[model samples]
Target chain A: MKNLLKHHETYVLLVIIIFSAIITVINPRFLTLENFFDVVKSYSFIGILAVGVTFVLISGGIDISFTAVATVAQYVMAVMIIRYGGNIFTAFLLAAAVGISLGLINATLIYFFNIPTIITTIATLNIYYGILIVISGGKWIYALPGWFRAFADIRLFTLCTDEGIKYGLSIITSIWILVVIIAWVILRYTKLGRGIYAMGGSMNAARRAGFNIFRTQMFVYSFTGLMAGLAGLVQALLVQTVAPNSIVGKELDVIAAVVLGGASLAGGVGTLFGTILGVTLIAIMSNGMTLMRVSSFWYNVFIGLIIILSVAFSAYQRRTKAKRAIAVEVE
Target chain B: MRSRHSELIILGCITTAIFALMWVFNPNQFLRIGNLQNMAFQLPELGLLSLAMMVTMLTGGINLSIIATANLSGIVTALILTAMINPDAPPPGSGGIIILAICAGLLTAMLIGLLNGILVAVIDVSPILATLGMMILVNGLTIVITKGYVISGLPNAVRFIGNGVVLGIPMGTIIFALCAGIMALILNLTVLGFNIYMVGSNPTASNFAGVNNTAVLIKTYIISGLYAGIAAMIMISRFNSAKAGYGESYLLVTILASVLGGTSAAGGFGKVSGLVMSLIILQIASSGFNLLGVSAFLTIAFWGFIIILVMVVNFISAKVLERKAA
Candidate 1:
């Protein structure tokens, strides 16, 4: 019981429960099982992206270019499928390849130039988006093959609400869950994952420990790229249109969710469970606001506030803990 | 100091090279006075923004909220100006109201900067995340206020500041020069400037040496905010309107310009002259491209490529210098 109380995930879960209770009190419809699935389905893309970023963050690097990579990959996938008539497997393969290549480019730049990850990613983000826009002429791709559209309707289970509306666990949500499970297993049981944690904890120490820095970095960034690419496909499937610019600005939302999930920006600490809870909290907040009929603009305002406050709270806690440790040493 | 001088010379060479290339491409149109004046008018807003981003970079921090603060400030001034001055029946003492509105805008930016400073320096949050949050918050507030619509119809005097010419120099250029001069003085001559470099280079050492790192950081961000406010004034005046999303693309460009100026991404090394030179180089290239009818999107890609290329060059040069010294 004491151990559970000390966990960041516990607090996140508590907040989720209390916040959901408040929202349900304000709007009774928010408590419906249908709304639960709706929120999960709507935010599955973000959850996937957050999971990918969690790996990068825990590896002591940041990648703001993932959204750009996702867009470029999905754009290529859409173009390929639309023009050549490929199956879903082909589409996924194309996206992952594009994503991995772009992610490798980011890794190569960081490794060779020794530039900071944030700076390198920012530059690449623009480069990728600019090239995409220039080549595509900012055109939105529509009329995806019927097979691709049908893939979105593939749900494992289905239920009917009182109003005869069908709500079920979606393939997208299942993909998110599968990604989380894979990430959890990797972080907990894999040597590569241990190397990532070591690198984030201290690069010099990790290097001294015989951890291959380049390989870990390559894996971390490319994993993010892969997830981003998949998320991009998921987005198109859900929306049924491929807009070139739809996914760029949501980088902050994903980063915020990951951070709120107890991932230190400085690196070396985070959990998949914590990240999922963070995503759920943010999704719930936005969904609750929509139900409450608040202005959509206020959604970003609240997110910004939550990011500052939560990070500040953690920093304060760390500072006091350090002070207390010093006091004990003096005694 | 020697390295700084060399960096400036390199930047100067690059600027001249681009200018010559543009001239060669379009000798007839590139050298026209009208074209030069147009470039001058367009340079200051971006120039001011680059400076805003530069100062924060010098402190080992970044103000991602700089553009958002600028837009919100411009919106605040726009709201005041539109409310106070009736375009149909202009008031006699409207200039005072315009000044007041401008002040209000600057104050709004300062307040946002203060919040960002508190979050970063006082609360110990990372600079990138803190300013990013502030950026989103400010942007949201601006959206809420303007409801995603453009505000326009400013009085003539306010427009004069952005468009007026004096002694053959554009008003915006003159304002940019004055601001740059002030910025140069602040970074080079002031105690605060010394402390800023010290804190950025080594925060623990500076703290041990009795520097108030928190106060210095707060002051640094406040100055950054002031520059953003000044840029906002010029932006709104030149466009003759204010909106929630003006200059969204400028954010990346500012970072690019700062990096191209030889500002160390890790902080503690930069120069105003270097930054000014890089800004001119960018303006020349962008204007030349416009004359060449190149797509604007390609130019953006080129800017990204240039940032990465410059970093690589800097790294190689530093390595060569180290080897030579050995």
Candidate 2:
């Protein structure tokens, strides 16, 4: 029981349950399947990005340029589809390719130039966004093809309520779930996944263990780039428009969700389960606040408090645990 | 010390080169007093912000909340100014009232900094996450107070600090110089400054040497907050208005300037003179681009390229030096 309670995911799950209970109590409507689908569908893109970022964070590197990569990827995909009449497969391919290349740019800069990950990403974030803005002239890509818009409406399962409203699990939400499952498999079973954890835990130790640092980093960043591209496509489909600057500043939200899910920014400790819970908690919190009729302005304040509190709680827990172990050894 | 000197000299040469190039490209427009003063007026806001970022980075941490703190401080001052003085009434505003407003604004920024310090230093939260949270919280508060509207119509006295000239120099530039000089002294001559570098470079060694890392970090962030507060005053005074989202773009530029000036991102090892030199270089390039009618977006792209180029140059030079030593 104690070991189970000590797990970070346990605490995250507990918070989700308690918070959901509170929200449901305040507004019973929040308990419905419809709202559940709504929240998950709407936040699926963030979920995808969070999952991708979890890999990088677990590899002990930070990437802030993912959002910029997403923006550029989605913009290019949208432009191509609108200009040349490509299908969904073409869209995904274009976004993924663009994302991979951009991600490689980040990796190369960090590897060859020996620049810090955060610094390289920050510089690249500006470069990518500036180039996009210069080329696109800050124009919004509208009038997307009907087929692309139709893809968003596909649902896996359908349910009908007595009130005659039909709701189903959205394709975007399924995509998020698929991404999560894939990431879990990669982290749990793959050698590359183990290498990522080892590297994040201690880079020198991992290097001594014969793990290819360069290949691991290349894979990590490029994977994130690929995810960002997909997320961008998901975003464009959901919104039905692509705005040049809409996606860049929200990098913090995704980072917060990942961190809140028990991913340490210091690197090497996080879980896919915790990340999903974190994303859910954030989505529900925002959604519930809207249901509760709270001022929208207070949203950031609450998120900030939650992030600080959770991280502080975990830090305190770790310190106490270390002290207890030390005392035990002395005894 | 030798490396620091060389870094500054190299930065100086680069700044001079950029300046000469701007003059050569647009000889008539680049050197006009009006344009010069305009650049002078603009340089201080970013300069002060870079200093704010540098102090914390010196301790191996970053204060992402600097822009938020500035905006919040500016809002508080604007709220006070607007509340205490009526625009249509006689005796526009008293000196005491203005001073009170300024103090209140600074106080707000300091309190936010204190929160950041406690979270980062005492609570052991990472600096990036802590400040990022503070940034969001403070921004939310700014929005709630301002309701997403601009607070305009400030008294002339307050505006003077941002727009007034002092003996051929803009008041903003003069103030920036004073602050930069004091900052240089703090980093060079004070025990706290020494401790900051020690803690940043290696916290374990510093702690074993009897330096209080927590206190130094807290003090460092508070000082960073104070700089942000000063920046707020200049920003509000110059714009004659305050808003929740002012100067959002300056956040990244401040980091760019710091790194270009030779501050390592991993912390420990930066010089105020180097930062100042880099800031001048950026301002000149920025202003020069404006004079040359280069697209603003392209200028941003240029800044990004310059940062990468600087880092690459530094890396290659370090490697060459290492080989020579071997």
Top candidate on TM-score is: 2
Instruction: Kindly state the fnat score of candidate 2.
Output: 0.70
Off by over 4 Å in 2: A326-331, B90-93
Clashing pairs in 1: none
CAPRI verdict (incorrect, acceptable, medium, high) for model 1: medium
**Minimal lDDT window, size 10, model 1 chain A:** A322-331
Error of 1 at B268 (Å): 0.8
- Per DockQ, the best of the predicted structures is 2
Q: What is the lDDT of residue B94 in candidate 1?
A: 88
* Highest lDDT scorer: 2
TM-score, per-candidate, Cα-based: 0.97, 0.97
lDDT (tens digit, per residue) of candidate 1 on B110-211: 888888888889988888888987887888889989998999999989999899999989999999999999999998999998998898898988999999
What TM-score number comes out for model 1?
A: 0.97
